[model samples]
Target: MATSSDSMLAISVFPSLTGAESVSDEELAKQSVINYVEAVQTGNIYESVKWVVDTRFSSTDEQLEQYKESLSSNPFSDVSIKSIVPASNDTFTASVELTRKDDGETNKVSYQVIKRTIVGRY
Candidate 1:
């Protein structure tokens, strides 16, 4: 089994603005963030990656669609949100904890945030 201190999870963050006002409740905002991440971590690629709202990340609509179709069959798992740090007024970076279903090893997934949504993964 692959075991390491770093999981090398590639969490890509995008630089797109949602333009929505920040939630006043910190805990609520955190939960909202967790919910977004968890949705993507479930690996419903079509539904998950669609949350990424950055043009630079998608490049083209076709690419995003293709990515969704390709990753849908790949193995993925549910994750636990360990920590979330606000990087900007709306953006946050979070540490995602997971146990590989295939190997049973624990690992962490870190990513840049795009506020109020799941950034994306590739």
Candidate 2:
């Protein structure tokens, strides 16, 4: 009773149902670091904050304001991920090279990225 189009739709939906093609923890951690760095480089505070779960910022609004202020004071022209190494089961250490917009000086910094699932309210 299924057409070719129906078969194709079922094929695509099968992976989502089975959860067989899920991304690994290491890969997810690496991607989080990359996304965070990209967001910071582009001055996207909203996106940047989404990748971070720091206790210093009391609220989302506070984090946004702080990130915005920090970015304005010390902005980077470019950020490149040099390496990402697994530190633990769900944690990764990423080495990144950043070029300062003010003086164009390149500096290497390492960031600890922890992958946590965000619970969605439906």
Candidate 3:
């Protein structure tokens, strides 16, 4: 006696019910880098922290403020991922290019992104 809504809920809860495959490690790492860079460029502290695991910041608030200050000081016109290479099983090195908003200068940077599983989620 289940309704269509009930069926939808079940499918949403169990993705395997729809035959959807899990994301690969490489794809996850690449997406992590993209999300982190996008969040930084947009000055979104919360979103930026989601993809980063750093111990340098004393606390979440401190990290947010630091990222905010950095973004305000050096705004970017564009940020793009040039390449992503696997550095280890769960780590990837991404090459990125950024264009400054004020001077239109481009700079290349490398980011080491590590995929972690926390509470049964990637």
Candidate 4:
């Protein structure tokens, strides 16, 4: 059975449902950011790239390929998605905290405002 997180991720990424079931753009954008963070946490570059609207992390095919290869040994240990706030109709600001696996250090955080396309088509 899929968990609530999984369900939310699906709803956020794929907004289409039965007729008359619609997801707001803000909700979609918020979910997309969450999905992106989850992808990064799992070290799945392909998944992460799926949610990116522009060349924030990579701009070229070669760079994307390199990112795919780098997922094998992810630098971060854990990721905590703090908040997803809507910036505009199709944009959201996500706050995330990343923890290094090597040391027991914490307190590191980042805020990323992502603009998601209708279907994230590049």
Candidate 5:
């Protein structure tokens, strides 16, 4: 959920700090976050990469491989977006949850989450 204080700070911070006065679009941020959690739950590496930030976290091979492995092995049934709220004007946080449903022989997994996203594609 986007908090009032967080929104206030975002509206104030970026112009001076990042140069961009406005914060990322709420819908875009929210979608990015949604895609991220959904991809993770579904173990779709390609989908996961689409919204991933190009930063230090993507550089380490060890962590990357581990994440890949984990995603590959997960038996995801579905992913659901729950809620999104702003933490700051430019920054928002989301809540996510995952579940596994058993169908006699196997279990299907799913994800439920809330906030966060990227620059353009909302």
Candidate 6:
């Protein structure tokens, strides 16, 4: 069994804006949030979670399995971003709901404030 700390080390946040101190535009923040959510819904289980999740959330592929297990154990297989708010120029927060196709029960899981370095927008 992996310790909590070990499990936490699995995810590695790639180089991307975290929406904290780096982004403030509601539209952009919201869009990014949308993109992140979309990526997960459309992406493979392993690759999808990496897009919006940080390393501290989980470690190792097995740990990620646990995450999947949690969702699978429930009824939701996909997560949808219901809303987003700009916490600050460097912080963007989103309220997301996880729903399962089988049960149709949506559970809310807050991903805290997503922050990131500023990436130029077209």
CA-lDDT, candidates in order: 0.49, 0.63, 0.64, 0.53, 0.46, 0.49
Candidate with better TM-score, 4 vs 5? 4
Residues 10-82 of candidate 3 have per-residue lDDT tens digits of: 0011223324348566666676777777777777878777767656677879878877887888888888888
Which runs in model 6 stand beyond 4 Å of their true positions? 1-25, 55-58, 75-80, 118-122
Over the full model, what C-alpha lDDT does candidate 4 score relative to the true structure? 0.53
Cα TM-score per model: 0.51, 0.73, 0.75, 0.59, 0.50, 0.52
lDDT of 3: 0.64
- Candidate 1 off by > 4 Å: 1-22, 25-32, 53-78, 116-122
Tens digits of lDDT, candidate 6, 1-122: 11111111112132243444454355555665555556455544565454444554446576467656654664447666666665556555566777666767666655444444322321
The candidate that wins on TM-score is: 3
Tell me model 2's lDDT, rounded to 2 decimals: 0.63
Ranking by TM-score: 3, 2, 4, 6, 1, 5
- Candidate 1 lands at a TM-score of 0.51
Among the numbered candidates, top lDDT falls to: 3
- To one decimal, what is the Cα RMSD in angstroms of model 2 from the true structure? 14.8
**Order of all candidates by lDDT, from best down to worst?**
3, 2, 4, 6, 1, 5
Clashing pairs in 3: none
Error of 1 at 61 (Å): 6.5
User: How close to the true structure is residue 79 of candidate 1, measured as C-alpha lDDT?
Assistant: 65
| Tens-digit lDDT track of model 4 for 10-93 | 224544442323766565555666777687777777677566543343365754676666555436677676777765554555
Model 5 C-alpha lDDT per residue in residues 1-120, reported as the tens digit of each score: 111111111111222345444554565555566666676676776656555543435454654676687665644465455556665554555544444434323322222222232343
Error of 6 at 49 (Å): 3.2
Better of 2 and 3 by lDDT: 3
49 Cα displacement, candidate 2 (Å): 0.6
For candidate 3, the TM-score is 0.75
lDDT of 4 at 109: 45
